[model samples]
Structure formats: structure tokens, C-alpha cells
Target: MIGKLSSKEGVVNVLVSWLPLEDNWYARILDENLTILSLYETGDILLANHIKLENFVIKNILKLSAIYCYCGNSLSTKAYGLAHDQIRKCLFDMNYDKSDIVFNTNSAQLCSECDANFDRVNLPEDFKKNLKKDLKKLKKDFFYRVYDFVQTKPKISIVIATIFALFINILSNYLYEIIMGRANLPIFLVSPFVVIWNYFT
Candidate 1:
């Protein structure tokens, strides 16, 4: 099914197919302007919200875009072996296992080697920086981001949540005193639900 895909000038063409690629790859960059994405056995990825396929498509797009912008057709190969199985959450992670794509998508950063390589590239000044920022943005949903943050730093998360709750309490108390006129901050603090219910009734 991938045979009909033909590369075009001044464009990036990605062919998404269900046929298994050689070496069980999720995707492969055939040329600077062409990539092959396979859906075969993609269900094994075990990613959040069925993000495996989308991640593959975005990964190829961004990777090839950076390479093309950096050196046009002068760059020898795609950004595949740059990570060399390091799994450093870098945009160019080899991810030979394919499932490691999950890590590459979220928390992706430019490794020192790749960073230095980009420094020598032909792109404009901020291209690599923007690429890093964009790659980092391709992470899990907001709920999972907060969940992971709290899981990783329980104490800090608790402190931040407590501070937010306290600030909300203070703001609500002041607003209530202004709006309701007779509602004291002390009364609101003691039984907020009772005060609100009593006021309405």
C-alpha cells in the first residue's frame, strides 16, 4: 500500500500504512521530504489516550522539518542515529524498541550532542530553541501532566495546592463581605456551606 506514495518538491509527504515495515519499525524517514508511518501492531504502544500513532506522525514531521531547515539537502541522514539508543528523552532518540516513543514524545529535550550539532547547523538563530520547545509541548494531557508533577514532587505539590486554596479562600471571603454586606469573613470561614445555603434560602 505504501508504493503509491511519491515524494514531491518543496513538501513533506508522510504515508501512513498498516503494513509492517522492515525491523518492525513504527516509522522510517525514506528521504528528506518523504516518511513512511506504519500502523501495524501500533496497539502495543500502550500510550495515554491512544497517542502512539499521532506521536509517530508528529515525530517524523518535526524531525524532518528541523533537518531540512538546518541544512536543506546537505545533511547526510535524518536525525535517527544521533541519539544512538541513549533514550535521553531527546527529540532524536533512536528508540529502537519503538515503544520508547512514549518517552520521546513527553519530556523530550535536546541532548548535549544534538544541541551542539544544531549549533553548527545552517538554520536561523532560534530554530533549534523553538524545536526543543515544540517537542516538549507534545506531551500527555494537562491532567496527566499535573498528576505526574504531583507524583514526582509530593511535598512541593502539596505546598502549592495549599497556597492556592488559601488564596482562593481569602479572595472569596473579601468578595462575599462586599457583595453580601452582612457576611463576615469569620462566619464564612467557619461554615461556608451553611452560610451560603442560609443566605439563599
Candidate 2:
């Protein structure tokens, strides 16, 4: 579950949790003083399903009722607090007007104000082309970051295993020499035993 709080001043606080055996659920409420708002939810799927809903809360309080209905069936009451905290943090970090963001269950878009402002920028043809080129470069950079993050775990494991295997081979040969009074064992015989011991140990 994840939770968040947002204030009219644009401050946000976030919290998250995971419980495998629990159902998913969420809720948002105006602060008792009505000076702030909160959104919260619980469930394994809550984060993925309710992210857009959080955006909606930032846009409209009425949308909170709708999101509550959509997520109520899948999450527990405990999840709501976690969801609220996470949403709050996101809102606090955002630099734009909260109302300028709109949520879609299937897709999201900027509010009309943002759309109007964007259109008013009125870039020249060359500037638009340059912007596109920059966006493509940004996408390529993001892709590489994701690729490296995903590849790191497997690569580290492989390197560690190779080094460990080598270490065990050396240790086994030293031990065999000690036991047999310095007679060298065949590489094949020593290597197989080293691999088996490395794995089992």
C-alpha cells in the first residue's frame, strides 16, 4: 500500500508498504481542519492501478470518490494510509500547479491551461526540430540507464562466481598438495572437485 498528503501550499508527503497476503484498497480525505488533503491505498496492485488516481486527486477532489470506488474492492483499509503518504511525496516534489495535471484511467494529459500555454510557446520550425532531436536523445539516455540497471545484477553474479571458483580451485590444490606431500594433482581431477565443493559449501 502507498499513501500521501498534499497541502494547498504544494507540500506533499509520501509513504509506501507491501503485504503479499492482503487485498487492495484506497481512500483520500480532507484534513480535519480542511487545510490539507490525503490519499491512501493498500494492495499488491495498488501502486500501479492508483497512480493515475493520485494524479486525479491532485486535479479534483470529486475524483477522489470515483477512485475510492475503483480501488475499494482490491485493497485493505491499511493500504489507504500507505497510498496517501506516497501521493503526498509526489505532489510535494512536483513543480507545476497541481490543477494543471489531469488523470485518465487509460491515459493522462495536461490540463487545458497547460495545453494553452504550451501552444502559445510558438517555437520556430528550427527550434521545434531541435526540440525533437533533444527528446530523442533523452529517450536514448533513459533506455541506457534502464538497460544498465537491469544488466548489473546478472553481470555481478557471473563475475563473483568466476572469482569464487578460481579461489576454490587454488585452495583445493593447496590442500591436496599438503595432504599428498607436494605431489601435483591432475588439473581435471582438482578442477571438478573444486567446482563441487564451491557449490555445496
lDDT of 2 by residue, 32-139 (tens): 212223233222122343234443333333223212222332222332332221222221113122332222211223344323333554433453334223322311
**TM-scores of the candidates in the order shown:** 0.68, 0.23
Model 1 misplaced regions, further than 4 Å: 1-9, 41-46, 49-56, 69-79, 124-126, 182-201
Give the lowest summed-lDDT range of ten residues in model 1. 1-10
Residue-level lDDT tens digits of model 1 in 79-146: 55465678887777887886777777665778898888877757766877788777766766678778
Clashes, model 1: 0
User: What TM-score should be assigned to candidate 1?
Assistant: 0.68
